[model samples]
Target: MKFLKQFGIILGVSFIGEVLKYFIPLPIPASIYGLVIMLLLLSVKIVSVEQVKDTGSYLIEIMPVMFIPAAVGLITMWSELKSLWFPLCVITVVTTVIVMAAAGRVTQFIIRMEKRQKE
Candidate 1:
């Protein structure tokens, strides 16, 4: 019953996100809106961590299973992807390096800020 309630809360938030996404003109996905709403709710203590922790943890544990369909879809399109594989790989590697560099810079900035605060 507790799990059901937690799951219901999540789904309710997601449904609100979907409604917002439908009305808004932005290109953002419903899931992103749902996540932001969930974060805000959790941050404000409107939704306690204890309320959702168990179900959230369970969802996280099974997250990889969620990607299986996407993997299979990609595999089904392999022939089309094969022609662009080289360029796709190059783009993936380049973007990954760029993201890593950006993340490192952000981390360093945050660390510096923390150090300044401590002094």
Candidate 2:
């Protein structure tokens, strides 16, 4: 019933994203594109939050499980990782800092733009 409807919406959005990914030559992940599409739909009131809340919550609850395979793959690469540990750590830390800084700047810019529009 309601659950099936929500599942159908999620599946439909994901399928459309996959189709676009195959046709588009973007570097971003298809799931991210799907998320963007979903967000746009929600923002435009084409899809109500109530319609997707259950499915969204269920996905969020199971998010940790999605990382298990990636974690296992990393574990299997431990030996190779150990050899490059120092460089990997440096790169990871540097990239994280850069990403954080960039995100903060983008957020500030967006907020300022919104404020200007309001004023």
Candidate 3:
């Protein structure tokens, strides 16, 4: 029953996001909007973390399964992707390196701030 309630909350929020997407002209995806709403609810204490933590963790645990369909789709589209392979590889590698560098810098900055606060 608790799981059901938590799942209901998540689905309700996601439905609101979908509705917003339909009524609004913005290009953002429904999932992103749902996440933002969830974040806001948690931050404002409108929804406690304990209320959703179990369901969220369960979802996370099954997330890898969610990618299976996309992976299969990619496999089916391999012939079409074959010609663009080199460019795709280059872009992936470049973006990954850039993201890693940015994340590292942000982590370092955060650690420095924490150390300063302790002093």
Candidate 4:
């Protein structure tokens, strides 16, 4: 019952995201919007972390299972993807490096801020 309530909150946020997507012209995904909404709600104390923490942790634990269908789809589309494999690989590596660098910088900045606050 508690998990259901938390999951319901998540679904409500996602539904709001979908509605925003319908009205907005941007190509962004509803999932991203929902994530942002969830973050804001938690940060602002509009939604307590404890309310969703357990359910969220459970979902995260099973996240790898979510990729199974994507993996299968890739396998099924191997013939088409084979022709663009080189370019795809290059793009993947480049984007991965960029994301890693950006994340590292962000984490460093946050750590510095926390240290300064403690000093």
Clashes of 1: 0
Worst 10 residues of 1 by lDDT: 49-58
lDDT values, one for every candidate: 0.97, 0.94, 0.97, 0.96
Q: How far is candidate 3 from the true structure (C-alpha RMSD, Å)?
A: 1.9
Q: Which residues of candidate 4, in runs, are more than 4 Å off?
A: none
Better-scoring candidate (lDDT), 2 or 4: 4
lDDT winner between candidates 3 and 4: 3
For residues 1-119, write the lDDT of model 1, one tens digit per residue.
99999999999999999999999989999999999999999999999999999999999999999999999999999999999999999999999999999999999999999999999
TM-score of each predicted structure versus truth: 0.88, 0.84, 0.86, 0.95
What tens digits encode model 3's per-residue C-alpha lDDT throughout 34-61?
9999999999999999999999999999
RMSD of model 2 against the true structure: 1.8
Q: Compared with the true structure, what per-residue lDDT tens digits does model 4 show for residues 86-115?
A: 999999999999999999999999999999
Segments of candidate 2 deviating more than 4 angstroms:
none
Candidate 3 Cα lDDT to native: 0.97
